[model samples]
Target: MPQPLIRRAGSADADVLTAVGAETFVETFGHLYPETDLRRYLAEAYALDRTRADLADPAKASWIVEADGEVIGYALAGPCALPHPEVTPDCGELKRIYLRRAWQGGGLGARLFGETMAWLQARGPRTVWLGVWSENHGAQRFYARHGFEKAGEYDFHVGDTVDREYILTRPPVSFSTVTTKTALDEHNLA
Candidate 1:
């Protein structure tokens, strides 16, 4: 397979972004919700207008992965919104990283994650946090592998269904302090 082209997403890419966002999201979690609820949530969350606004947001740093000229995955990190009272102004959040199932085990996710972390770290945020669905063990493990730790819990509303989510935080710059040459060079990280 041709290597996926990864790059910072621009405002003009909103349609493709919305497509991948909604597609990957539904692929991952669609069965958990009623079809009407899922459709409503996708319209509310990943509609073209909403995605265009998101792409235009200065605080949001986004990237897309494409193969054969088709967008298949995306990652976004920016201003933290985890509702913990202790979260400070300096924290940023790993807002979303959605890839088609065909792209899941291919290391594209890690590359995108690494690039996203480097971007957030460049912004000098003290840390980055993410909210993962409590039942999504794979996602929890993925975040753990990326240096995030479960710091707390929160409720996430997907339309009318409330999901229990775990809030995980990682100090973005702290990974730079490590001196392992192979580790740093081989794995893109914080």
Candidate 2:
């Protein structure tokens, strides 16, 4: 396994980042998100140009992980919409944390997640949150292991399927002050 370097992503890396995002999404959720709707969602959410814009946006923070000098994973965090009818104050969200299929299970996911959480922490957001489809048991388990607990429920449209997602959060997680040096015994890369 090659060493994966995690760094702050810039506009120049948008194209590869976008591609990584699409591939990761397809590999991770293709079965959960219908095939027809998958392409549409990927196109809309991860188009190269849109990713470039996002990297430039002050409201969003993104990072990329490279192995063998190739971008294989990326994570994005930013302000997210809360679905609760009862309003709450500001909270940071982990919009996406994706890794190419070949990169999964390598402890790279933990590295990316720790970095993203640290990034959000520096932004002064009180809580770090994200949503995972209820059916994505793997992701749910991952989030749980990282201290994210189910906070609420919401519905979304994926292709033609209406699905439920659990809103999860790590309360008052401060990225600037958090240091996650806890490393797992690496078994295999992906």
Candidate 3:
């Protein structure tokens, strides 16, 4: 396949974003919820109006990956909203990162993650956080490889169903105290 194109998302792309968001969510976690619950969750979470507003928000950043002119994946980052005590206004959250099953294991997810992280830290390093389903071992390991540690746990609601989610955090790195090499090695980014 040709290399996928990754670009910043805008309000005009809301419909496509909404579709891909729902598709990827169902592809990954549909079995975990009841039919009605899953439908309700997807409708609320991937609503076109909500997506358009998020895309237009200056405080958030989103990127979409396309291959053959079709969106195959996306990543979103914004001000932290995780319900952790240590979270502050300056902190950032990686709200979502999803790629179709066909596109997995080809390093595209990592590339998308790197881009989102760069955007989150562009103003300077601050705490970065994410939430992953507690049962999703592969995702947990992936976050660990990126220097995130399990900081806490919370219940994530999907309609009437609730899922245990691990809140992973990457503490802010002060460049003054840590060398570039050390920081890179710490995050396994080098």
Best by lDDT: 3
lDDT of 1: 0.81
Q: Give the distance in Å from residue 76's predicted Cα in candidate 3 to where it truly belongs.
A: 0.8
Q: How well does each candidate superpose onto the true structure, as a TM-score?
A: 0.89, 0.86, 0.91
Each model's lDDT comes to 0.81, 0.78, 0.88
Instruction: Give lDDT for model 3.
Output: 0.88
lDDT of each residue in 1-190, candidate 1, tens digit only: 7889889999988888888899899999999998887888999989899888888999887899999998889988888889988688788888999888987775677777777777777745478888899999988987776678999998887888889999998765643532232245335533
Q: After superposition, how far is residue 41 of candidate 2 from its true place, in Å?
A: 1.8
Superposition error at 110 for model 2 (Å): 0.9
Candidate 2 pairs with clashing backbones? 121-175
Better of 2 and 3 by lDDT: 3
Cα RMSD for candidates in order: 2.9, 2.9, 3.5
Estimate candidate 2's RMSD in Å.
2.9
